[model samples]
Target: MMKDLQNKTIGVFFGGQNPEHEISIITGEFVIAELRKMGLKVIAVYIDKNGIWYSNKKISELKFFQKDYAKKLENLSSCYLDLTLSRNKLVLHCNKFLSRKKIDIDFVFPTFHGLYGEDGTIQGLTEFFHVPYAGCGVYASSVSIDKGLTKKLLSSLNIPTTDFIISYRHEFTSNDDSLIFKIKRKLTFPVFVKPARAGSSIGITKVKNADELKVALALAFHYDTKIIVENSVENIVDLTCAVLSDGSKIVTSDVQESVFGSSDLFDYSMKYLEDGGAQTGNAESNLIIPANISNKHTEKIKEYSKHIFKEIDASGTIRVDFLLNKKTGELYANEINTLPGTLYHHLWEKTGYQINEVLEKMLLQGYARWRESKEIHKDFKTDVLNNANQLKLQHHSE
Candidate 1:
């Protein structure tokens, strides 16, 4: 599969009209570098904050996203996938000369983090064109991206997740007192309020009492219409395990425990801004690989991670986070990240797979999934269309 990929052109898509756009760009750059190291041809596709797409070799450079990025975009061509083209040929149309406008791509590696890119929108676009892309498909992507939906699905599957109450912007606005009453009645204080669809902890607040509940909900609603208020695990340790597949066997990476700094929660600044940020490779210090937990907890985390991965019908790679209550020794599934930052290659690395190996496996799994989907009979024999006139005549006679 790796050898076959060398002969094909892979498009690395990153950035978007998302809060996690910068993080996605970093992931794209990392993946592109790894693919290129394996001698694969890579096309860097950058989606600006305004949701416009551009393709250029310079996009792979970090400097292109820095100062005066607008002027730099003038040198690049804005591109879009021409879905009207044949399935065998995925053509990326760009605003350039006719000869240079169409770029053929055999596969896609989406490095998007949140919102439109990670929440099944881009996955649906690729599925519409019948193009092979990395990470989970539409269903899994859609389910995993929304916190409220993800929790509901997991609860139905008998998976243990932190107790959460979902609130909508309209409902909260119309009856703020009712919503607040429900939260006060159902859950205890010191709850975590989060935007249902946002990632990278962009719009999250830790509410300690009723006085802070309304403010937290308002902040969350600023990012997304729906918000989830989950009961806080007082003595909790954040553990994450990544799951990956090579289209045959599934494996889980080593569990890593997140060590938070002065922040009450692992907010946006802690994730991307502290210690020179994730792009500079210094933020890794906050995560402890082979987390200082009992072997039982580690195995259970791995088991839950794999189970959730299969249950969601996810392909490629994913990371499942858990909140382990230190006092009770209970673990609650936090959320599933279909497209984890940098694909969580760091976890896989500790689990004995190189970054290149992880990329190869992801690409191979995506290709195999696409091939399997092609085998299903899409053209079902139906006479309804042909007999429409006869049916109409019969109805008129009756």
Candidate 2:
């Protein structure tokens, strides 16, 4: 089955109208390179920030983007996913009068990070086109993006999470005092405010007082209408684990500690914009594999990771983050990255597997899941439509 998949064409999609667009481009390039190494026919599908889709061989190389090749119209061609076709295909054209080109794709490897990309938008599109996608489905992607909703879902399963308060933009703007008073009354000082639906820690702030909270709320609201404020955990250490499933069995990777050292918080600056340049693709270098935690903690994190993946019905490779107290042994799940940066390739690599092997497993798993979905009885053999009755209209005729 896996060998047969190597013969199919894969569409590598990246770049979107989100803050993580640049990172998505890097990830897309990495994925395209890895897929090509497996001797598969891969097509580059680049979606610019303006939501314009372009397909061309030149778009597959990173040097093209480094030189701003997208701005040159002659170097690229406009393309769109044709949903009218039975299979997922990319339609390329110069103009309506010109002959259009079509590229048939059997699978899609979406590398979108935030907003429409990871928030179920791209996954929904793949479903409409009837193609096997490489990550979570629409339901899981949408649910995982909302921090508040993810916490609620985990809490229902008896999972631990920090106490949080949800703040809406309208309420914060209408009466700032009332909202702040409620937050202070319910939670203590030194809270973390984050955009409800965002990635890369784009709009996150740690507030130590009411004055700081006000500024943090403004920044967070700028990114998303909904915001989540959680009581800061004492002596917190970031830990992350990745899970992969083949629709039946699920496996987890080793726990990796995110060492922030003296930094107050792991903001966007620390993750990407620090040092010389962006560290989006090289983030794994900062992680400490087999995190210096107790065996009990490691086992617990692995179990929780698998449980959360199954609970959310996530497919492909998904990474789950956690906040563990160094002083205490308490652990809480932070959030689930449906499409983690670099596909969490480092975590899987630590488990004694190469990138190609891991990706092949994901592709086979996604295809198997897609095939299983087709086995379900979507259209029941019922006569409800044929046995329907007509109703008379009861309205004044003009």
Q: What lDDT score belongs to each candidate, Candidate 1 first?
A: 0.86, 0.83
- List model 1 lDDT by residue over 33-132, tens digit each: 8888888999888899988888887888877787888888877778876767737546878887664577888888899989888989888877777888
- Candidate 2 per-residue lDDT, tens place, 292-314, comes to 89999999999999999988989
In order of listing, the candidates' clash counts read: 0, 0
Best by lDDT: 1
Off by over 4 Å in 1: 97-100, 278-281, 389-398
Shift in Å, residue 384, candidate 2: 4.1
TM-score per candidate: 0.94, 0.93
Model 2 regions more than 4 Å off: 73-75, 86-97, 275-285, 381-398
